[model samples]
Target: MNASRRDLLKLGTLAAAGSFLPAAALANAGSGVIEKAAKPLRILILGGTGFTGPFQVNYALARGHKVTLFNRGKRPSPEWPGEVEQLHGDRNTGDLKSLEGREWDVCIDNPTSLPFWVRDAGKVLAGKVGHYLFISTISVYADGSKPGMTEDAKLAEYKGKDAMAETMETLRADIENLYGALKALSEAEAHKQFGDQVTIVRPGYIVGPRDETDRFTYWPKRIAQGGEVLVPGDGLDPVQIIDGRDLGEWMIRLAEKGTRGTFNAVGPDYELTMDSMLHGCHAVTGGKVTFTHFPVADIPEDVGLPIWVPREGTPFSGYGAVSNAKAIAEGLTFRPLATTVTELLTWYRALPAERQAEVRAGIPLDKEAELLKAFHAKQGA
Candidate 1:
């Protein structure tokens, strides 16, 4: 199954009633920032309806910039600000035919994972936009197994012969195997056109409100229910995640500063363990639950654990620990994990009964119970 399939389901459901989310339930109200740019520029967002794209649009609008969205108009975001300009044309079919002669001070590409998409957009926006920011991921790195890796780290190379195929079917077929290589190739396509004008943002797991993945949000919702929660690896394993809201704001800032080159954008700026993250969730939501930490090996191979990367031998070896020095030095900051958990729970709870029926990541209740039984039996033996 596509790991991000559920992320697409929640794309249109911005369940929050308004801009203000419940903060009283949260223990920490992260360092809030309202940016007032030195000079606002017109910004174009290639994909504004998905996970982090709306946040980017909202932050750009808040920072006083004109925002235009380019997509096929399949998923319309009703929650977006009313002023967003929409241009409809499929990059795969039209090669950005709708964007000809259009110009923006900066263009943000949040949905382009295919090099063909980048090449198509580049053909149109080459001289029109002053800055081109491509949203890449830490997955682009050749080896995430090594901790403290930075932007200069080795990148994954596309194994496929054709780097320009832009079909969702192609993505679905090769995601598990070639996703990283393709993403790195896409980043290269952006650079091929814009050179120094490109700003590559390699973010780790992006979580927070408006995130449909339920990858990180799984903890907040699960803990709030309160029970014998099955946890992995003694709960001391460090995990790294960057909030979508924080990233959205930082993108606008980077564009305003006209930043160029690659940056590893992931962090809370320090070490954060699984237990500390769960504590924040429990404290914020008042979940009266007891966690049973099991050895990583105890976790059944079939049971999926969200956010807890296995340690023995995995491609995501350094997943819990990656460096963000370059991005931090350029003014990237993070909100407390508490604030993220609280708001996420608040939003998840507000969803309709049907919307909250299933989560995309993490073990299901039935699987957890079975795994816990075996785990305890082994301990007794």
Candidate 2:
């Protein structure tokens, strides 16, 4: 099963209403660190109201870069720190009339899942922008069972009849089979249009504030509740993730330096295991949380546990171990694990009470309890 299949189910769900991080936390998010460019660059972001785009906008403004956002004007946008030009267009229907004759120093394609989105934008953006940056996923790898895979790893191929003709409706009809392959094709299409000026960033499990998916947020919130925690696997499975803020900020820096190449935008600059991740998040909470280990087999096939994948007999077993050495060598950095956990919980706590009651990802408490009981009984027998 695809690791991100669960997340796609929550697609089109807008950011939770009343989602706001504490002002102090926002101030501290990128404190003591600044990557200002030598000269201001005109930066254009395709989709700037989503999880990571706001971070990019804020950081770019702080670094004295002029920023512009192009997206369907359906969602609410945050208050930008500096002036930002907003243009509206629908890429799904191939309506990119708004971008004609516009030029920018760099273009960041944040939400291109369909190859046609790239094809349509390329018609308007080719040679208009100095650089093209496409945000792709780590799922593009054809064989994810191998540990330490790099950007050169074989990518999944589009098995569809016509990749350029595939639409959002068609993609949703078979997202599990097409999402990765389509993204891989989109990367190729971007290269075909922009050549050496294209930058492909492949990231896994982007978790932090303003993320409504709650894939990684489930852990911090569950641990904060102060009770028995049912942990899948022996807690030895390697895990890789990048805070969205780190990713967004780094992309701006990449645009500033004109860094061009494919890089795995994963985190920590070191090896991180599920054991370390859980305990690291737990450290930020004052609640008493005791964890009980359970076999990966105990997890029901229908149940999707966020961010924990067993190494034995599992597809994408090496998903958590993909190499980020190339990205690190190019100035990729990570915030403290505690910071990610704290800010996520802080942002989550600010959500409406009704929204707080909804757990977007991870096992339900009752189901988790039942599984834990079953695991204990088998051990006793």
Candidate 3:
């Protein structure tokens, strides 16, 4: 059955209640509500104009916190409600002078892709910020993790100081392991500088509105076109995504509650499978999508798939599923997958017609049709 936005909102509300309620009341109310604490927080967010930064900005604003943004002032955005201060600086050359004398309750580091950059920033803002939150990725784990790996499992080690030099190019050519290692090193540096004041949020694929890159948008856009859809691999591989807004909310909550430690900020620990993810997209778009599941052996040698592709012998082996119990226990909850997909589609539709064409041109229609046919055939089988 197709899931509606209303249904997804209801699910999110219920999940929030269950996730935020106290343990004693959880049994009777099935709600997750923690005691409210009042300490108006002032936050500074690095990389506030990026894909995930805006959501974080919105979330903090909603919670009645003051926010200061540090960026290069390249991409200007709509003015935010409430008090928002923007500082101009570049982290590459260590020109964070604008933030020299400032102090905030918490600082969310969203753009520290390199260890040196993180180390420099941490050195500058160490004692000034109360809590330093570094947004890391799930890629920090070993290449092939056990089914559901927790935070303390096999972590990637830093190769060297110049490890993140070729991040952009390497990330595209399937060298995310190095990227993760550098980020892991960066997180370690932040903790080293601030100790117990650091909170590391390692998230899976993050999807939501105002997404400049259409990585996750491709699925919803293709499904909304209403035809056969492509199924990579068995269509049973587990897929997890944390909505940008949910990640933002949880980050603010952590700052408010002074939560610490490395938490896996993912979705509900429920029966989520690859097929269910695709199905959720189909339901949200109200499109009839037939999946054509391609066997590992039958995948065309030259067919370039941009997303996850597992190595041989391990169907779910390449990217291991992350456990969110730690984050949930610390008051992390997810906005339903259905809601995320719908909002993603809505944002895509709101784009200019020319921009939409530009995005769709990335994928060849014939290849998409073939994949959809394969996915549908697999569904029937």
Best by lDDT: 2
Error of 3 at 345 (Å): 1.1
Preferred candidate (lDDT higher): 1 or 2: 2
How close is every model to the real structure, measured as TM-score?
A: 0.90, 0.94, 0.81
What digit string (tens of lDDT, one per residue) describes model 2 on residues 35-99?
56799999999988878888888888889899999999887778776799999999988888989
Residue-level lDDT of model 1, residues 1-381, one tens digit each, is 212322221222221222233222221235445556779899999977666677777777767788999988887454544388988889767557779988999999987677888888888899999999988877777786667788888988777767775465786576755667778888888988887899999887787876666778788888888889988877777777888778877888899999988888888898888898888788897847999987776665556666665443565767667788889999998988877887777777787777688766787888888888988888899
Per-residue lDDT over 1-381 for candidate 3, one digit per residue giving the tens place of the 0 to 100 score: 111112111111111110111112111122234343376789999877665666667666656788899988877554554567999988877788998988898999886656777877877898999999988876677544455678887777765446536444553353434566676788888888888899999876666665545656777787788766656677666666667667776788898988889988767567566678778878888856677665655556555443333433542254426678888889887767777777666666766677777652124677666655665577789
**Between 2 and 3, whose lDDT is larger?**
2
Report per-prediction Cα RMSD to one decimal. Answer: 4.4, 2.6, 8.8
State how far residue 43 of model 3 sits from its true place (Å): 0.7
Backbone clashes, candidate 2: 0
Off by over 4 Å in 2: 1-30, 33-35
Write the number of the candidate with greater TM-score, choosing between 1 and 3: 1
lDDT of each: 0.75, 0.82, 0.65
Clashes of each: 0, 0, 18
